[model samples]
Target: MKETPLCLTVGHLLPYSMTDFNTTDFTNPSTFILLGIPGLEAAHVWISIPFCTMYAIAILGNSTILFIVKKEPSLHGPMYYFLCMLAVTDLGLSTSMLPKMLSIFWFNSKEISFSACLTQMYFIHCFSVIQSGILVAMALDRYVAICHPLRYSTILTNPIVAKISLAVVLRGGMLALRYPILARQWPYCKTNIIPQPYCTHIAMVNLACADTRISSYYGLFVLFCVMGLDVIFITMSYIQILRVIFSLPTKDARLKTFWTCGSHLFVILAFYIPGLFISLLSRFGQNVLLHFHVLIANVYLLMPLVLNPIIYGVRTKQIRDRLFRLFTHEGA
Candidate 1:
């Protein structure tokens, strides 16, 4: 009888004995180990400090935005409603990863059950997709307000905004729900080690013994159909918005309109660019460094969460004024 050595490779499962591997159950993998930031395991403690800071800011900043929006009657408009939706999605996105990430870094606890990994993957991707949808909804709101001021009120009523938020959640949730289901059915007899800090559909799928072309293609399809289309429509809306802004006779009006959109545009770019880069790199950049992929993925998750509230606070006068008033009142 010959014994086989278990080899752990980057972005792959451990090779098991042929006889034992053939008989191993795929659906019932006792545990999956998460290898956080391959080749930099020694620096994980130092890495966790900045990540923890960003997580704290994400929670506190987004919470403040939600509090101001809910308390300020002046913010009860379509734009702010969309802003609130964005804050909630950012919160969900950060919370989904931070706890597990900290545990891996601080406690060196990397073992995740098969079912738990699937659930985490589902929410991380779902919230991400929903955030993109929220950005699109905000773009449409801006389009109506700037392109057709008179009809803005009637077109984007409270009910309509509510419906839009509901649709965003449903669209993202329904599509992302398929990832975990599909990944679960595949036989994961190879290795149970994920190289990234957290579980992702792509990372998990890559671990399976079965061919995962279908899962890969389906994930790409949803990414383009949902997020790609949202980016396209957002661009179109901004084009029309720019046309409307330039046509205004008064420079003050143009500036005001631009100011209104500044924070959202910043947030949109913050959310989409890193996301697109990571998606592209993961799919096509086989030669790219694994650490680069890990870094960008973390950026994509943390950037929007940390920057959005700050952008809104500094760029939007209403939120800023409310924040100032709240603080001043507390001081007095």
Candidate 2:
């Protein structure tokens, strides 16, 4: 069977198929229709219940963490300061996408304006990068506290923490700015249906009819430079932390030191493992199921946000005490 030519023009001799194909809208659409989890469309309502619940937990938990950290003078140290940064980043990360996702699932409102999609992409990736950097900062705080106990306070002072926070913000914003800029330059002559619920750099790039190699390469570059370096720095910091922990005099001392670092390590794993898995799956797992990819993507975005506050609250003794006292006092 020979394929019909998409555009054939010999005056009135042109076939109906060619005429229709040629007249088919090739211009960029002003808005995109997001098909939330392609194969699981019927289950979107059920899927949204958990997603909405996770978003609510993330918002409440992160907000509580921020409030407690702000009010507690005892938590004014570098570790708690970094925790506050993480809380804010988690809030931004979940808030960037969850509302639109819920709207898509519940009301079948999947249309997202072109500019709005780019903005969403920027915020989502920007906050994610900032969160990764903050995790590294937190790991460094632990390393200093454990490895250089006497100098910990001096090393990670308030001014230094502020500077690190500034650097994290600048790096995340600058790196993420390129995504929206590059995406905006691409002519989206293809279909405007983004497969995922949220707009991502690659997703927008994929909609372009032009050669997308540059965007693809750049996305990979940013991913490896930011997330890759972050993972390495975090790993090295924890390795040193572990070495110091093991070298401590007593078993109880070692346990205490490890316990202090345990929450951060769990948070780091929760943030990175699913993220890296999703990245790898998107890049290489072509044969993998589509619904699974969408599901993991949603999890990658929400799980750490929802779990971070819980993990820190339960694991950090001071936060637990503060929270308990706050609740009990309110009840009284």
Residue range 140-180, candidate 1, lDDT tens digits = 99999889989999999999999999999998899889988
TM-score of each: 0.90, 0.91
lDDT of each: 0.81, 0.80
Candidate 2 residue lDDT tens string, 107-214: 999999999999998998799888888998998898899999999878998899999999999989998898889888888775777767888877766567778787
Clash numbers, per candidate: 1, 0
User: Which has the greatest TM-score?
Assistant: 2
Give the runs in model 1 whose Cα sits over 4 Å from its true position.
Answer: 1-27, 279-287
